[model samples]
Target chain A: MTKERKPKPVFIEGAISAEFIGNSIAKHQSKTTIGAHDIFLGQVRADQIEGKTVKAIEYTAYEDMANSKFHDIREATFKKFNLTCMHIYHSLGTVKAGEICLFVFVSSPRRVDVFNAIEYLVNTIKEQVPIFGKEIFEDQSHQWKVNS
Target chain B: MTLKIKYFGMLAEITQCEEETLSFSKGTAADLLKVLFEKHPILEEKEFQIAQNQTFISNDSIISNAEIVLLPPFAGG
Candidate 1:
């Protein structure tokens, strides 16, 4: 006899909500030896750049590609680090300049790997994900976000 | 064969459209890019990258005759 297992769909949702993220984290937890939890929330900054006031941000993504890349990132993180659970959420569509664009939460049995894993997952997501955000200035001018 | 190519970021600006179909034979993605650059000279120094489906491709890598997608620098946070 043989058994087959289907991979869980990579939890990807593009919405402008924080409650959804909180719920995701709640569901990911189980009765395991989880000792540490670390989270990184990226908020949109209202800043003055070149004499322009920032307005809202428009986010776009290659949906199919982004989903697949996220799956790979999740798998790689699990393989490279010891973690109890992890969740990554990013907003799409329009987000105001003072809104959040991304959130990453990682939990592990110990604290050491959680920190490194969080950093790695976040860095990789920024470097590899096929997502773009346009920073709309108050004057209606626009600029693309560049990862530096 | 015709390769359905998609563009993003500044590359989309240079192409003047989000996507287009190009007639290209089985060759490296760089070749198609070179041809694209020839037609659109503004893409010469745009600082971009490429990906065939889900896999990242180097500048000199060969692209299959099948449909391929081109991507620019990522900005996902």
Candidate 2:
């Protein structure tokens, strides 16, 4: 039976630690009906631009609007896929290079649904959400990051 | 009527403030842009989309909402 889910807060203050991700996976262990699981992690890359190397990224968002958009995405994903549960988390503040900035987890009775749902959720979040990233360079300079 | 306007991302950098209130009587989104452009000329050169009531609207869309947002290119994952 599909369970009705409410929109939960998705923004984290800083980098999402491995411990948090591990705990989340551990929590799902009790749900034996979930036959497959899929996860996606977005890491902050040290990109080079204009000869300056990025050291970290400072993220910001239109919180109320972002949360509303996230809720819509969650609802749509649930409608499209036969998933048991899903979770999404994104970093709001400075996330250094090599740190995890976004985490998406999905589970279902089978593998195909989890795979498709993960892709849709990540792409929709990237294209539609109002989250902004300011790339901080090693030299202390910065520039706005645009998804390419 | 006073409208609350919000600027996001690079657009906010140009405006120097994340949000503000402006006194505007009646017009389309284009007319509101004219007033904003006059106040912050640099905003005219920046690329952005206008949203009202959390939904994107065309330039000619009538301004009936009390809140508007200027959003630049999104960089999210």
Best by lDDT: 2
Clashes of each: 3, 0
Clashing pairs in 1: B28-B62, B28-B63, B29-B63
**Model 2 agreement with the true structure over B1-77: per-residue lDDT tens digits:** 89999999888887898999999989999999999999999998888889998899998999999999999988887
Docking class of 2: high
Instruction: List lDDT for all candidates, in order.
Output: 0.77, 0.94
RMSD of each: 3.0, 1.4
Q: Candidate 1: which stretches are off by over 4 Å? A: A1-16, A28-32
Instruction: Kindly report the interface RMSD of candidate 1, rounded to 1 decimal.
Output: 1.2
Predict model 1's lDDT versus the native.
0.77
Docking class of 1: medium
Q: Pick the candidate with the highest DockQ.
A: 2
For every prediction, compared with the true complex, DockQ reads 0.73, 0.88
> For model 1, what is the error of residue B67's alpha carbon versus the real structure, in angstroms, after optimal superposition?
2.0
